[model samples]
Target: MSKMYLELAKRNLQRAKVRSLLAVIGILIGVMAVSAIGIFGESLKAAVLQNFEDVANELIVSPNFQEGYKYLDEKDISRIKKLPNVAEAIPIKSDSLLVESKKKKSYAVVYAMDEKDVEDMFKAEKGSIRLKSSCVVGKRLAEFADIRVNSKITIAGREFRVAAILEDTGARFDINPNSAIILSPEDFEKVSDVGYTMLIVKAESLEKVDDVKKEIEEKINSRDEKVVVFDLKIILERINEAFSQINTFLMAIASVSLLVAGVSILNIMLMSTIERTKEIGIMRAIGAYRSTILRIFLMEALILGLIGSAIGSVLSIAGGYAIDLMILQDASYVFRLSTLLYISLGFSIGVMVSVLSGLYPAWKASRLEPIEALRYE
Candidate 1:
């Protein structure tokens, strides 16, 4: 009996193929938008977290004073390095500047830090990191500017030799090395002021990271120039929280289209109810139970939702890949396990919205009296 009702529901949809197709297209667009945005957001966050994975056991300290802000100077660096469980405290001076090659000019992040620390964070893809008036360019930056070892690039009107090309590391905590130019402290001071942006302190062991972080904060707080401390763990947590809020906001915006699709489903179902009133009257007169009538109408709705969601799920994969390629510029960032979950979720939500929208039409169809329905023109 259930199979008979299912067959009737499918036949009803086939009778008005154009209307069914329009409804499916609406839900498909809604699900595609939602799943695409979700995949992009998750991929971006994954890239960021992956960049920070190397420095997970380190803490970053920078001045947070309101009026008289002081940079993390030699004394502060020394103080941090001397603390128990502390291994290395490296000061990094970073800024955004325009760099130009013979090809073109592009804005890039410039990092001037200790040569040894730079070597620890990045490796040379082409040449060696020699301490001089030379700089190392990241893989993407080098590719973009057509730079290589022995190439001369201009930074703030000063020309410097490209000593090495660093391997790509994706997006890091605050900067992307793949899009940055790096310099030693000697070369950095020649172009810009002698002030460190932040200090990266490595704890002796992973277990001592918390202990070293607490001690560093205490030391910085006791000084007149207070500084903020952020361990990599804390930074990851904050990044996750921030992205969660952003993802939720974007998903909400995408859901507006789904709501529109729901309205489309509602209108179609109501039209279907009106068209089938006489058929319903015949069924009622033939001793079909009211519950059976309700179930049949509801089954029609479920069928519509199921078909729409299935098509939407397949379209979302192509849509997600296109978005990643256009926005992230990284083809390697395809669908992950989390992406599959997002697709499944979008399909489920689309089906639920469709079924809910059909409820009123189903109820109205079920409540029609046989005499009144049959008397209709």
Candidate 2:
């Protein structure tokens, strides 16, 4: 029975190929618009989360700097270490310097930290970190500079060997880690001032994060000291909130296309009902039930929707890639799984819109009296 209904639906749609194609095009456009924005949003969220994965369990303390340029030094680190629930306080110093390879020159953030403290944080894509007088180049920095293991690069007028190439971290805190250079504290001191820019503190456990943060603030005691505490979880939550608002706004804009598609479906289905009225009346007279007639018409709409959605989903991959290239400038940040899921969602929405839009027309066709429909024709 289902097969018969589907066959009838197929035949009916086939009789008006051009009209069916146009309706499918309308649905495809709607799905594509919604899907493009959804893919971009998911990609952005994934990039942010991936960038923070290594540091999500850590808290950052930096200068409030409301009054003047204040620095976080060893003294503040010592105080924070003594606080209850504290685990370790590691200081990081950062400065921007010109980096030059044989092929290219780029400005890069140079980070100075205790190599032992951040040993586990480094994921090498090409080589290894040997720590003294050697620099670990980020994935992007290595690519941009066209350097690799044993490649010599000059930074801040000092020459160093590229001991390792770190894996690309899709996002970063202040500077993109994928485009940064890591060095030991002592080495960095030789090139620039030893003033610490920030402190990374590990809590005894995730539960102790808030307590550790408060104690550090109390120990620092003043904005003059330039102490500002940032909880990673709170930062993540805020980012999620901001992106949620952005996603909603983007989806609203995309939904306008879908509304237009729905109207197109409604008009097409109504016209189909009028054109097939005599045929419907003949079927009713031949002992076909009203439910069967309705189902057949609804099936036709579903088929159109499914075809449109399939095409749109496939094209969304290209659309997503274009969006990433134009906006994100890197394919590394686009989350593949989430993108596929969003495309599937777009397809489902397109199908649902088509079926719902066909409802009234299907009902009206099912209601046509056999005698009146046949006599009119």
Candidate 3:
């Protein structure tokens, strides 16, 4: 029965090649919108996460102070280390300063992560620890700042040799606004005799991140003389939430195009049904069951959807590659495979919609009386 139904469906589709083609195109467009959004979201997330890990582990601890820098000190670092799921704790300070290397110059965020902790967090070809008189350069910063390996640079009247150059890892966030400079704990002390500002903490896994966060938060909240400063994770979360809303808006806008496609599909199917009213009546008169007639029309819709979606999906893949190229050229990030999965899923959704949209038209076509159809002919 299924095979016979499929054959009838195929024949009907073949009879209206142009209309079927247009319906498929509609499905393809809807799927393509989904694909583009999915690719951007996943790849951007990966790039951001890579920056997060580059800091340390799965977690970070900031002064839980209710005030500001006044509430944070070295003591918080020690306490955070004792918290559950925290394997290591390191103090870091990052601030922007005026810098000059030879005649070249830049204003950059100078990081003060623990030499060993930063070393453990990331690997370098040369040196991770800079002597009190030296520092390291991030890849993008090095290129932008135009400094060479082992070259000497001065920040805030303190001169230091460029002890190492970090390799490229697509860590735009960690780079801290497109430019970042690394300084060892010793060098950090040179900048400010005051206590360190940030604590780098590592967790066992993603599961442990929240636990560690809560542990550190409660510990800091207990202290009486503290000023609250936004922790890095909280700030990052706020940023992520904002992006998610933007993504939602983008999807909502893209849906307009999908709706247009849906209407196109409806119109094409309706027109096809009207033009074939006599034929529909003849089939009914010849003893075709309503169910078979419905199946035949629905199959045509489904086939059209599949064709369009497949084409759109292929085009989306190509577009993703183009996007990847543009990102690499601009920010050194690339799309991941999960992004493609989203594209495929989007196409499938389009296919499902195509089938659904045809139901009413198909049912209408199946109900024609043979006598009336012949009389009209």
Candidate 4:
């Protein structure tokens, strides 16, 4: 009996091919918009988070110039190291100097730190960090200056060997190592007398980052706000929260299309009900129940929804991949579980809207008086 009703529903939809096709197209656009937008947002967030993954457990402490502090000193470094949950406090001195390599000259940011700290913070893409009379150059600096390992470079009139080239560290708040040079403290003093500029503190563990930051703020800024503690973990959390809100806003905007599709479904179902009135009257007069009539009409809507949502969900993968490539320069996030969940959400919403839109039309068709329906033109 259910099979017979489904067959009837299918046949009825086939009778008005153009109307059915329009309805399906409407649903397809709606679902594709929602799912593709969702996937794009997730991919963007994932790309941003990946850049911060390695540095999230670290904190950057620099002097607050507004408080009359010029630079972070040995005292500040000492205070930070003594704080609870602090693993390592690396003092950094930075200055800009003219660099000459292979007859090419450029100004590059120079950092002065211990060899151990350099080993802990950065990895060499080309050579090792010895930092005796030699220095490590960032990848960008090496490329721009045309310097390589064992190559002699002149910095501030003092000659030094380029011992290593650091790997590119993309988008960092603490230090941009990709366009700078690192030298030992003894070598740094030969060119500039600038004191420590900042301290990079590593927390004992990820969970202890907040505690370490708070302790540094309280202890170091006890008299006045001498230094500012920047917790990368907190920044990461805020970034994730911001992306989540943006994703919700984007999904809401996309849902407007689905609402329009729902209205189209309602109009199509109502017109279908009116056109099939006499046919329904005959069936009712013979033996069909109101519930049976209702199910048949709903089955039509269900079929339309299923067909549209399935196609939309499949197409959304390609849509999402294109969006990710254009914006993030990568499309790997489209296959993530979180992205697929969004596609499923769009599919479910499409089917639900279709069924809901058909409810009133199906009810009206079921309640029609057989005599009146039969007399209608």
What would the TM-scores of all predictions be? 0.70, 0.66, 0.73, 0.84
Write candidate 1's Cα lDDT for 32-135 as tens digits: 88887887888878876777777877888887757366677568778888999988887888888879999979888898877887788888888997657889
Give all candidates' CA lDDT scores: 0.83, 0.83, 0.69, 0.91
lDDT of 4 by residue, 133-153 (tens): 999999988888788999999
Candidate 3 achieves a global lDDT of 0.69
Model 1 residue 180 distance off true place after TM-score fit, in angstroms: 12
What is the lDDT, from 0 to 100, of the residue 376 in candidate 4?
82
Worst 10 residues of 1 by lDDT: 168-177
The sequence of per-residue lDDT tens digits that candidate 3 reaches over residues 110-205 is 877756765665555555545457787777777877877788888877888988877665543223423567777678778755456566566766
- Please write out the lDDT profile of model 2 over residues 85-153, one tens digit for every residue: 887778889999888899998788998876776466667888777768898888887888789999899
Badly placed stretches (over 4 Å) of model 3 are 56-76, 92-114, 118-129, 132-192, 220-231, 235-240, 255-257, 327-337
**Using lDDT as the measure, what is the rank order of every candidate, best first?**
4, 1, 2, 3
Index of the highest-TM-score prediction: 4
Task: Name the candidate that leads on lDDT.
Answer: 4
What C-alpha lDDT does candidate 4 achieve relative to the native structure? 0.91
Give candidates' CA RMSD values in order. 6.3, 6.6, 4.8, 3.2
